[model samples]
Target: MSNDRVLNICFHGVGEPQRELEPGEDVYWVTADRFAAILDEVSTWPVPVRLSFDDGNASDVEIGLPALVERGLTAEFFLLAGRLDTPGSVDSAGVAKLRSAGMPIGSHGMAHRSWRGLSAAETTAEFDTARTVLAEAAGAPITTAACPLGRYDRRVLSALRDRGYTRIYTSDRRPARSGAWLQPRYSVRHHDTPASMRSGVLAPAPLPARARALAVGTVKRWR
Candidate 1:
């Protein structure tokens, strides 16, 4: 509950996916009722909480947006440039709608591939082209990104920084410094419930545990 720290929660698909899910992707898709309940829980947290949705799922605008609006909450949505307009995913119109609704849109890259160790051409496609496509769709500058699959390395981080991304989110499941350029987030998954989230995320970690988590993040940054 320290003012210097913030809880960043991330969501993927909600309910049934309209299009075919990637292998192991179903684990991140939560039931509609579960999503609502989790939102309710987070809304009441005493500490600062930031919300974000990834993968450009159609459910983002369909189900997620309305629920967030009902609670007077807004979340950042990361869009996949390549997946736009495809079945079950948020299209260009949906991206525009989110922007109009006061939701910030960030690039989730051209494809949903990991950002770690990408070749030069792949990096250009993922970072430059995807940001261009999403900015056009959102009608605003896209200055933030969520690493695809929450995978990144030192090189990936450096590339994003050099590309002028103001913020980059990762699914590291740890509380993050509020002003950190590279923010870590706890991703809500299929089996996560309000109780589990409160105990696992909201509760303060012991000093030793916090150190271990920090160490893990350091290792990831350099490995």
Candidate 2:
């Protein structure tokens, strides 16, 4: 495995959500059993893997943390600034627990909306205020973010770059260069099995599919 590349696997809520889910959000939640199994499978992979969890879901602290600890793995937990301490979500104390457990934190913005089109104020709220709030909770500076809903355009990317974001994570389902500013990740879905994950994520994507991914990324960067 080369140190120049990595496979970023992102996870969302696991087990039963404590709060009402957003419309179509259920697709991202995987069962605890399946989550563990997938982790076991990924453990055997030879390449370097970067694990991340989005949303400030309580399950992150309740289930996700313990599982990672058991496997001797650490993940970056991107939390929603607005959703922190809300019902069904991870609270400030939960963030503390994750930090104490040696997990790094990143911002998922104030609201869990798409980051494609926005007014200046919305940008400030999402990019500025959210980072401040999340940093306060984490007791550290937040210099990284994952695009909410996996949505971002050229303008959005520029805004993040302007703010000095070290790296941005996207749901592009592809391999990523280790030190790239923009990192593509494969999101775990509700129905995914360990075998399915291996075939879908760990395996090299076919030539046509890789071309499509490259084209899509180019468009997103330039659009």
lDDT tens readout by residue for model 1, 92-210: 88887898889999999999999887889999999999999899888899999999999999999999999999999999999999999989999999999999998888876444544
Q: Candidate 1, TM-score vs. the true structure?
A: 0.91
Determine which window of 10 residues in candidate 2 has minimal summed lDDT: 204-213
Q: Which segments of model 2 are wrong by more than 4 Å?
A: 1-3, 205-223
| Cα lDDT over the full model 2 | 0.91
lDDT of 2 by residue, 39-156 (tens): 8888776567899999989999999999999999999999999999999999999999999999999999999999889889999999999999999999999999999999999999
Report clash pairs, candidate 1: none
**Any idea what lDDT model 1 has?**
0.91
Q: Look at candidate 2 and tell me the lDDT of residue 221.
A: 40
